[model samples]
Target: MNRTSFRGKGKRVEFPFREAFWMSLEQIRKRLKRSIILVGSIALGISLLTHLEMTNVILATYMSSMGSTMEAYQFWLIIVSLFVCGIGLINANLIAIYERYREIGTMKCLGAMDQHVMKLFLIESLIFGAVGGVLGFSFGTITAIASSSVQLGINALSFTPLEAILRYLAISTGLSVLLSVISTMYPALRAARLNPVEALRHNI
Candidate 1:
């Protein structure tokens, strides 16, 4: 949605968000090689996160819904699962930060402001994170459902599978986007702070 705003002298100005968005997409495309791993890492991390979340929900549900005794090992399972997922998230984003220093420098040298540079990377991460979330949710839900169905009837997997799936999807999506943006902040800041000339000398 485009909104009219006054900058000065009562003149209307158009914010170029659509343009900036497209440029961000273009930049992501240009760096597809670098982006692939980041996206994959995010996807893997989100998948694990979603899986862990679902396990917690479903196990609790199973206990209440089916009246099963909870096992001691399950507690350790959840902790380990979350620990592994956290590691993946850290590793992937760190690698992306390491790889993009030159790109950041180039953007800085090209008259991009600090906020603009940060915005570009933040937007890119959000896009990647969203994609990763969807993929992760799909994989996590499918596996969870499949494994659950093998132990219990498909009908008993939940009160309603679709409702549960949608809920998990929403949860995973929110978490993935949040993590992506947070992970991106330091790198974005690093990029934004680079001296343009020094950056260009090394990166460009």
Candidate 2:
């Protein structure tokens, strides 16, 4: 059995999976500060929004007798926080695109396909989203407890509905991840569609 024949016998080796994976990591490493900023922004947004929404649910569903008025703040916070977070996430991804023009061009010139570029950016964003989701939920829950404590004079967290708390954590994390990916989509596509020639010429 000639090893050479077997080695050269495969269909064209396309799927730049390994390259894209490593490059995705490299992209994050190189832009560590920006990545951190993006993740933090997302986490803050998700945490605050989740905390407020969950608070509203608990109050409305369980304690409607006493805190009906407070629920208004929770509702508005959810809407405003999410909108701001969405804007920040989109801008962060777009900034990454502008910053990485040269890298993208280099990869394309080195024979990477457009889809590979797209996949790399997507992988980066997904990783960011997952990390953000976890951290955001943790912080949000803690903040909620603290705020509740203040409102209820140190007995705030003691009265929380465990089921509602768990439910909100799961939902908020999922929402954070989903929103993160959605916001990154446009910029990722734009980066993938860049003409290698023009990309190389681009200086930013």
Candidate 3:
């Protein structure tokens, strides 16, 4: 919580990321049910994505004879899954903003600016996305390995490239965070643009 004061303009307060991070955690804790739903949604989407990618990699690595038809199908499936996930996130965040109208109003009255409100929501999403992504990736990777081992023998796991697995892990996690942030943009902006008086009067 560092504050920088402008000359002759009163205090221009800036919400530090550290404070925003803790505040976001507190909000999530208070809204446990909604938070869980959002996290689960993200995890389900990411898991499906990871499962497909890992399966494809395993199949391609162990069976190079596999044709492009499967890869094309997977590409479309992944796109559809991601699109659905993004829509869910946007809907959830909009509801969250509706429910938190009074809270946002109070913060604005207390000198919190639009960016502060936006940062809080984005940070919350980032946390949820990262957690969900890691969980999904782990589950997907394990499932992929187990099924592949059964079909292709234990040697399949041993021969799978560690570098590729690590790379996808990074990709999946980053993708989740990116998607969450992007999905929240509209909701956050709406929340930010709300008039304090109107927001305070919002019945939700």
Candidate 4:
């Protein structure tokens, strides 16, 4: 097979799959970076929320304890922290989706099906969610295990129940999936509705 290359001032070459793949990969990378940041923000917010919930649970169990006031402050901190983080994540993904309109259009021009484009975004979200889940789960488990022995300045604490920890992990993973789905929906819809000619004309 003879492959033609445009050189010097001769002919303008047609785009090939190899070139398209690289271009798409670059676009995907850019999108992924943005998504990762969003994920970080979302996770931070969720962790805060979890922290607040956990504190409330503790306080509920120790209603007669003297440190309920301090526990309330801790609970508020966790809730507020998570709220901010969640907002950051949502905005980051939204911006990324908007920025990639051109690339989405390009893919459509090259006969990439709308469904495939949606799947591409979905796969990216799944990859991020899976990796984040594994890391967060491991870290939380380790922290819980380590907390078993630590003598807190405020109060002596027992190890977190393993079953309770696993339940938390399951819930977190479920929420991550929900967020991924919600994040992908608008972008996927836009990609599905792209006009090929305008898509190609769309600059970064």
Candidate 5:
């Protein structure tokens, strides 16, 4: 009896981590597949901007090389990159809003607060962004290192290696979280407004 009571006392009431984790994973998996489709479309639009950026970069490089210009085209490329990123962010969030209604509704039904549900989704997005950002950064960095090694010795890369990696990771994660928050606002608002009876009546 003492053992049983001790065990019972040791189990504390907390957020349902296991169930929530699985549910969130499913939501993310679905979102990933959908986002990829939307992103693929957006990537095509981005490619045009990228080519324009390349042209601008080449022209700016020419100008710089000839001592005729002060700023590199790369500076302007950052602006266009942000614009493309914003569009991609909007697309990703819109898709999430459309796709995750059922999951959101289920969370609401389970006595989870609307804000908590929203946070859950937001956290999911953050995790996806972090994992993807880190992996992509690592892969790209390695590829760049390898390619440069063949052409101009590994040490020829001008960046302070650790500082560059940290800067890229920080920027990537921050931008990702910003985009995720913006993308989630609409859906989060909708989830917050759900009336329990109506939420249950409709299939998400």
Candidate 6:
């Protein structure tokens, strides 16, 4: 397949995935506050999920019994939290689109394609998700261990299976990334479809 190229200064510039990836990173850096907010949102949701799952796993290990009733309740709570998180993420991305209207317009005017815009946004979301997931997992696991220690008097740490903990960590992190990407889709699409002239004229 032929690589996509954009026109700039009368020259055809190849806008490869690698360039988009770097641009995404630069965008995150430039929009540090927004990026931090996005990451925090992802972390909050992931952390809540991780905390509950880790708690359950620890309890099950120590007691050799799972609490179906409590698990069900917590599962619903997690679902609600994730739903809220998704909403927040979508709102943030939309706001980002609004804030960057001129930038987007300029890029589009400079020959940036819709897919290029979408790729950049998606890449940024992916980076935020991965970072947030790691942070959330770490925080959640620590919180779980501390709480379990309080109840089980350090025996919890000793008895907790490393394999199970690692497994959950991987699962939780992957879920966080998935959630972030899914949540950003609509906003990314909207941004990609923006009319260059209208976007350039849009007042922030």
lDDT of all predictions: 0.66, 0.74, 0.83, 0.55, 0.52, 0.86
Candidate 3 matches the true fold with a TM-score of 0.89
Highest TM-score among the candidates is held by which one?
6
Off by over 4 Å in 4: 1-32, 56-90, 133-157
Off by over 4 Å in 1: 1-15, 52-98, 153-160
lDDT of 2 by residue, 42-105 (tens): 8988888766755555445445665534456666877788888888889888988998888778
lDDT of 4 at 7: 28
- Clashes per candidate, residues 3 or more apart or on different chains: 0, 0, 0, 1, 0, 0
Comparing 1 with 2 on lDDT, the higher-scoring candidate is 2
Task: Estimate candidate 5's RMSD in Å.
Answer: 8.0
Better of 3 and 6 by lDDT: 6
Which stretches of model 6 miss by more than 4 angstroms? 1-14, 67-70
* lDDT score at residue 44, model 6, on the 0-100 scale: 94
lDDT of 3: 0.83
Task: List, residue by residue over 1-204, the lDDT tens digit for candidate 5.
Answer: 011111112444234445555656666575667645543433333333333333333333334553323245755765666566666666666656655565555655655666566666666656555554454445545554555446445443442245545655566556555655565567666766677666555663
Q: Kindly list the per-residue Cα lDDT of model 3 for residues 112-203, writing each as its tens digit.
A: 88888888889998998899898888888888788888889887787567887898799889998898899999999999988999888888
**TM-score for each of the candidates:** 0.73, 0.81, 0.89, 0.62, 0.58, 0.91
Minimum summed lDDT over a 10-residue window in model 4 is located at 1-10
- Could you tell me which residue pairs clash in candidate 2? none
lDDT of 4 by residue, 1-204 (tens): 122121223443244445444444455566666656756655554554444444433443445453423356665775566456545555665677667677666666555666656665666666556555545555545443444335332342342444556776786667656655666677666666778777767676
Candidate 1, poorest ten consecutive residues by summed lDDT: 1-10
Residue 25 C-alpha lDDT in model 2: 74
Question: What's model 5's TM-score?
Answer: 0.58
